[model samples]
Target: MNYKDYYKIMAVDKTASQDEIKTSYRKLARKFHPDVSKEKDAETRFKDINEAYEVLRDKEKRAAYDQLGSNWKAGQSGFTPPPSWQDQYQQGNGNFNAGAGGQGDFSDFFESLFGGGFGGGQHAARGRRSMQGQDSNAKILIDLQDAYTGATRNFTLQDQVVDQQGRTQTKDRTLKVSIPKGIKPGQKIRLKKQGQAGVGGAPNGDLYLEVGFNPDSLYTIEGADITTELSISPWQAALGEKVKVPTPTGHIDLSLPKLISSGSKMRLKGRGLPCKVAGDFFVKLKIVFPKSLSTEEEALYQSLKALATNSDKNIEDEA
Candidate 1:
């Protein structure tokens, strides 16, 4: 677990209003969303943004975090906490505990600074009447290729657990998970009896794993369909030919119809993510003209212009 500066993550002033926080979050969220963004480390950056928003958006949590003073830097290791940190506020009726489930994966420094139990008997009580153990959750990000062909993923989880000293300690556990074909983001896969331990022989709650997609450079996924923009030379659009296009699986030769207009989209049936009923992949053509043409090319264009080729495709006529 690492210490994170929520204010820096959201790029907001410490005294920023709720609306400002929300606006910043929305902007950053869209920029870093794995589905649409092509930036490197988009998923990690998006998770950090979500984690920041999770704490700062909440009034109580924000206030508590603010009390730590702006002097503390993120990722400051081995700094001993002040003894009288929590003396200003007494632990109340578990409002802080209530937030554990929804809050983004928090760090050890955050939990220690806040001074409340996020798991154990109290968490179990909140989930179900008979359960006496907390429900742990983790998010798994997989590539679109993995979804097409199911995969076995090995993940190590750092979970907070209570020790004999009654102090909370983070324990690491590794397990291999089977990613079923056709799983989508935001869907949770529940594993029964895999959560925290129960109190007094009570039944333990379940673990929920949320699914997400890895940030891909060449594809934008929507449901099962994949969309990618392809830049084509002017001649390629004018004269139909076989072109090589990249898919998540591999590059394949696709036939382009002759005289296709710029911005025309071509679809490949059943070439997207695998599902019970799979979707199509769409390639949108974008005509890219050279910034500077060669002398011969210019002469040819001038001749074509003189031949009244422009007469057939005037902007006004199209309009």
Candidate 2:
């Protein structure tokens, strides 16, 4: 199979963060979403974007892809995954399904790597008679605050199921689920009997909802902890100040220590996600200077520079 550069397809760098990948996917998905686009290759591009996102969005898949190295490019001839690639993935619990029922219109390259084309269906068919309904998987995007304080979210899941006559059909089901406080990303919230219906009156499979946070402009989550940048003026950082900072719970007065440098962090205990034990909220200090200095500001800066230069000379002389 030919090599496909997923990062290039998504117009992101290989080092792009999860948030950046999500942002790019949203922007491109809208532009080429087939139903909404007037472009000639809208359908094809849409499929490609989804295929790329299917791998890139997941941490495990992205890691496996990265292990393949950066030597291969799109349309590279005679490209193949490493000899141990299949074994590594098979042993791991990586979900190879690109989407519902693993029936997405993915490329041969993807199928070769992950092996979830017709093979998945064939495997399902073998034990179809006595098996319970296949477990359904879907993602729910919630705000960071939703994790702090539990929320009720509604999700529409599209699933493929076999009908009574053995014809496969697509069905859309809506579910309203309660998200528990402090739910971490990649954690599955299983809903019993909400999956595809089973044959022969067997019990229905459960639905697994993966918790994912929507990209927030102000905050980033790490486990139960939340981090955000606190921009302060140079004087405020140097002189220290009591600033009102926003947290997941609410706004609070944060005391910045005197002589605190840029990139320093202040921890607010018990302000993070309210799990069994509350996590801490962290504020990374960022000292910001005025883009343009006024006449008085310029004079003050020059005076400070002169004093610093003189101090350095005095120290040198004393040494």
Candidate 3:
């Protein structure tokens, strides 16, 4: 794979700001837009411009690219990424087109630097004695309960395989994965040798599964903390009462403050997802009022209204 000088591609300095980079992209895009441009290689130039903007526009991707340093010339063949680059940027293919490449059109150079791309993140281990297959990344959605108590699940992944014709092709591969307890969102699980096969009995690349929580009907997770709505009657909210509320862990009696407002939150420390620090549990109050009033209840409400009116009039008299 060749090294792509993103700055050179966009005709901008390496230190150009995001706004400047975007401005350059617009100009180049308009000049090379296949639909309107008269340039001979408009489409190819447009894709290159888009690819350059894709890397240079984002702070993280740009920073990762810059780490290769200015020593590498643009379009230089067989550009090898630095050793520590992968450790920092295990970017998942989960969002391919979120960047400037709207069509998932990126060069092998882009794919080699960024973990997720058509290359399956397996660049040849050119320098190492024992060839190590390139590691690949994919995302997995697990239940919030799995965070508290881990569970094992099976997943089907698209893996790159070399056929008899010496061509790379995708094949469906299944593997059972164990979701660890206390694993937070955005964390990754590394499964050994689950990726591309290595040549000459070299070590196979590993597969990384990025962890994500499935949307739950009753709960939402952020970091180690978890939140759930606790329903209570208007009277209970007004007078403060102990109520049984459901949590991810289990049911617990939660005390409500007097005159608690609807949507107000009460927190129970250490009741959230288990971790090194243990996130706190939060209960959001939802006050429900009866749709109808009984005849006797209406009569009692009238009496209370009279008393409240008299009290207001007394205050006015005193003033």
> Which one is best on TM-score?
3
- lDDT at 24 for candidate 2? 93
Off by over 4 Å in 3: 1-130, 160-162, 165-170
TM-score of each: 0.54, 0.57, 0.58
Candidate 3 worst ten-residue window by lDDT: 122-131
Candidates ranked by TM-score: 3, 2, 1
For TM-score, candidate 1 versus 3, the one ahead is: 3
Error of 1 at 260 (Å): 2.3
Candidate 1 ranges beyond 4 A from true positions = 1-132, 309-319
**C-alpha lDDT values of all predictions:** 0.72, 0.76, 0.74
Off by over 4 Å in 2: 1-131, 163-167
Ranking by lDDT: 2, 3, 1
Candidate achieving higher TM-score, 2 or 3: 3
In terms of lDDT, the best-performing candidate is 2
